[model samples]
Target: MPNALPWLDAAPVLAACAAVAGFLRPRRGTAEVFLVGAGPGDPDLLTVAAVKALGRADVVLYDALVGPGILDLAPKSALRVFVGKRSGAHAMAQEAISALIAARAAAGKVVVRLKGGDPMMFGRAGEEIDHLKARGIPVTVIPGITAALGCAASAGVSLTRRGVAATVHFVTAHRCDAGATPDWSRLADPEGTLCVYMGKEQASAVRGGLLAGGLDPATPVLAIENGTRPDERRVSGPLSALPDLTAALGGGPALIIIGWAVAGAEASSPVSAALAG
Candidate 1:
């Protein structure tokens, strides 16, 4: 028989090269899941490393609060999954999300679990990390600007001001139980700055709790909605007027800042002395 053509051997070589590439390729991304922080609704806030990771990602699982602009950073081929979670509306259960992350990572794809604000804060990132670790999946966290700080900065207010705010407290306005209340005694302290997250619907209850705890009804309150976003809104009034102001303004992620620092920042800082009295 005539000698096989030289190209005949090329087929085997190409198959071997493909096999090696498959084997050398990561079972996941450079890391299993890159837990990236989407930052406070701005594409400029994205770190250089985060930008690179976004380009390499095969999938991006993002949250509701994460601005739509961050999606522009991801690779065109990447699969974008929206696990929208409002204060009460959760599309995917926590457990399901964890499993989904691990499953995607295990499939030899770069997985980016993009969350708004800092992942370690009120982000519930601990649960996801624990779940991934339990399955021997690698995970990494990238910090971003948290809402409290982000809102304060964008509003040109400081969360803690020397001689004005001696302490700062971050609390959730709405908890798992609607009727449950936080420690009003501590929250009532006038010396500290209070940052209430996810309290839009319970604005009245929040104001009432603070007032009942002996906080001045006229204490200055700054309500920032959709902080750091284009439609961001800010209202300065007394704690008593927060509910009405927020209701009138309508729509956005409402964050409440209450304390002497709000008014102390300036003699006439827009804050009302409780119900505009």
Candidate 2:
């Protein structure tokens, strides 16, 4: 007998067709990889693109400097992995972390290698990028606010002031190779501002080297800890006293600034009194 209802006549066949289409068009896995800068301990400083990337990340591989507040922005369902290197404590080696990112991306998982400050600014992002590229894993880099810039901004100090500093030099306190020593004589030039990353622990040594290189012992130096964070603290003092001031505040991740321009900023900074106290 002819079916009374045309729709019902083909219901079983229609359901089978829909099931076949669903199987053929299975949701494609998103294996996007992003090397995003989280900024220096301050989530507010993060770029719009960086924030969006974090929101989309399936798994976030973050560094210690990325801070906690920024991590909270990711979905609760996302996998948050800690592959960070602490200031004094050893953790997962950099190579292992890079390898992990590549492997995860290959597994069709969205990978976000979140770093503190600009990814290119001593974040070891170059190595990670190279590793991923070598393995044919798709990768993109997003820059973020660096610690030196953020610290200077928070302290109201210009890294380069007109007429005061025509040049600004950013150097890392930590040696690239275990035993390498930086040329302090060139770094101690009075014409430019010197911004030191990872130099808090070696405050005394850094001061001594600068002093020996003709940088005035009384030269103005500002040491900022947890720069740009809510607990941000800055201690301004003469180069010779930098170590003592840093120790007194209890050390955290820090950036050190030295120059005539920095010394000239004493009026706006309350850090001088904080250090004196």
Candidate 3:
């Protein structure tokens, strides 16, 4: 009976195995935060630094504008947090999200704040940096292609040219407060380009502002929705017709480009005929 090989059931062995696994598990948590740009919508546009940071992240808090494909870059074990903001629907308040991120980093977790387009471009990276730095948290930033540049390339247009558009400017049609209004007088240069971010919903205001500020009503305007994405579309018309063009784009993140640069692009480029009215 000594050599019967049935001396033990599997219970103790399984318990010991579980104990060993718990003992061998790697300790999790680090003390660093990376602010990474996910580019407009194309994963191919992500910078190498962005990729490396995502690969090492213990948690990624990303914006709504960031595409799903970019989220795939994070490790399987990494915690993905949706700290996204849409038209009026913000998953979490900015202050709360900042606190959460700072708290997590203070807990020594490797965190990544993934935003769409260049983080410095209306991404509210400055606020985040201030929040983390106040707590003495180390933060790193990785830039990616912005939507304006991506749209220009995809739409075969230039924001500035030698003589056509001597200067190019970027602005956000979304005011920080209800009483705030952009100084349209400074942006009414027909010879200059104005690229507006978060501009779709306020297209009427944009049109009226530019028109009231003496910009040429016939100045060409272009709206690119989901730029650099496979479903990217370009709608072009005169400044006076910008409202119609903006409405045509439906619901999607878009940029409004205004200037002779748009006119020049349409003149020489072969864009989709279906995009024209």
Top lDDT model: 3
Q: Would you list the C-alpha lDDT of every candidate in the order shown? A: 0.78, 0.81, 0.83
TM-score of each: 0.83, 0.84, 0.85
How many backbone collisions does model 1 have?
Answer: 5
Kindly give the number of clashing pairs for every candidate: 5, 0, 1
lDDT of 3 at 192: 92
For 101-156, candidate 2 gives per-residue lDDT tens digits of 98788888878899999999988888988898888887878889999999898888
Question: lDDT by residue for model 1 over 11-89, one digit each (tens)?
Answer: 7889988875553344543446888877777677777656766777899999988876789888889999989688668
For residue 159, what is the lDDT in candidate 1?
76
Candidates arranged by lDDT, highest first: 3, 2, 1
Which portions of model 2 show Cα errors greater than 4 Å? 1-27, 264-277
Model 2 compared with the native: what TM-score?
0.84
Residue 60 miss distance in model 1 (angstroms): 0.5
Return whichever of 2 and 3 wins on lDDT: 3
Better of 1 and 2 by lDDT: 2
Residue pairs with colliding backbones in model 2 are none
